[model samples]
Target: MQTQVRVRGARRWIMFGAIGFGALFLVVGLILAGVSVSFLANAERARGTVVALEWRNDHNGVSRKNRENDEPVAYPVVEFTSADGTQRSFRSSTGSNPPSYEEGERVEVLYRADSPEDARIKGFASLWLLPLIFGGIGLGIAGVGTVVALATRGRS
Candidate 1:
């Protein structure tokens, strides 16, 4: 029947699309993991001072807090001197409600020699978070796609 043929064709296309997306996600995850490893290997360490806490409001509307004991997220502003003797200031990527760093506190900083502006607080959370998050999502998506492709192939 024409309808049966069309359904088969549609299932074939779905399988192909799922496989393609799975491959794409796997490749992206691998690349991100590689970059994260490279950064860890080559980063230089320096002493930095926390200059301030930058507050951020995540709520789209109304001034009321969204959750119990909710407070504005605060990211640290840090200043450090590079090996080249240039002073650089950067905001930390990590934020917390109670604030992890106090102003005028000294902390370790990790940065690339070629690009000092690309720096962060030297810690496990700052270093490993992005790669772990991206890789996890990518692997989850790819796994789902793989299951869909396999199930469709078995039916065929």
Candidate 2:
């Protein structure tokens, strides 16, 4: 029947979509992981202090229950002395709703010799979280696609 044929086609499309999206995520995750690894390998480590927390309004429009009373996120500004004894500071790209660090807190910093201004606070959240999330989602999506494909093939 034409209806049965259309159903099969639709299922096939869904399977392909899942696999395609999964592969995309997997590739991105791999690339990000690679970059993180490279950075870690080449970066110079130093002790630093949290000098200040820069507050900014959440513009990403993540809805909160008390939208009008939304508090600003806090991004830490770290100050560190490079190997060559030059003073440097950089604001962290990641932020938290509740302040994650207090001013005067000591932390480890990772930076490149060439560009110490683009330094990062060395932590799992700063580096590994994104790649892990993407890779996990990719694997789950690809697994679902594989299951659907196998089921459809069996029915055929």
Best by TM-score: 2
Off by over 4 Å in 1: 58-72, 96-100
What's model 1's lDDT at 139?
Answer: 70
Residue pairs clashing, model 2 = none
Q: Going through the candidates in order, what is the number of backbone clashes in each? A: 0, 0
Q: What C-alpha lDDT values do all the predictions have? A: 0.83, 0.91
lDDT agreement of model 2 with the native: 0.91
Using lDDT as the measure, which candidate wins? 2
Error of 1 at 156 (Å): 2.0
Residue pairs clashing in model 1 are: none
Q: What TM-score quantifies how close candidate 2 is to the native fold?
A: 0.90
Per-model TM-score versus the true fold: 0.72, 0.90
Query: What would the per-residue lDDT of candidate 2 be over residues 44-151, giving only the tens digit for each residue?
Result: 999999999999987676678657767888999999999999999999987887888899999999999999987999988788988999988998898899888998
